[model samples]
Target: MEVDVKLFGDLREGRFEQEKTQLEENSRVIDVIKKCNLPLEHVAVCFVNNCQAEFGQVLEDGDRIAFSPPVGGM
Candidate 1:
């Protein structure tokens, strides 16, 4: 299975690639993040195919995942 992925914030900067990536079948959202070495603690939000998702969410083929890092400031 192939999944479309989008990384935001520091993760993208670290990987230097914002393009979609293909992953194996039954891959979880956290799996992709791990591939980029991103810490879930730093993520503010995550979406799968436009719906809010969690680390345990399983990704399907053609699924689109997006990540946004947490921002802190007053």
Candidate 2:
């Protein structure tokens, strides 16, 4: 299956802003993070097709996955 991935904050520092990636059927949110070479600890949140998602959330073809890294601000 193919999915769209979006990286935010530090997550995008050395990665593309967005990408179209391929994964096996039933791939999960954490699988995408691993494929992107991002540390699991760096992700603060994840959204699938605009809805908040958990690491184990199974991904579907054409699903849009967005990841946000930990942010610090006043």
Best by TM-score: 2
Candidate 1 — which residues are off by over 4 angstroms? none
Model 1 C-alpha lDDT versus the unseen true structure = 0.80
TM-score per model over all chains: 0.80, 0.94
lDDT tens per residue, model 2, 1-74: 99999999889987899999999999999999999999988899899999999999999999999999877751
In candidate 1, position 28 carries an lDDT of: 95
Cα lDDT for residue 62, candidate 2 = 97
lDDT score, residue 53, model 2? 98
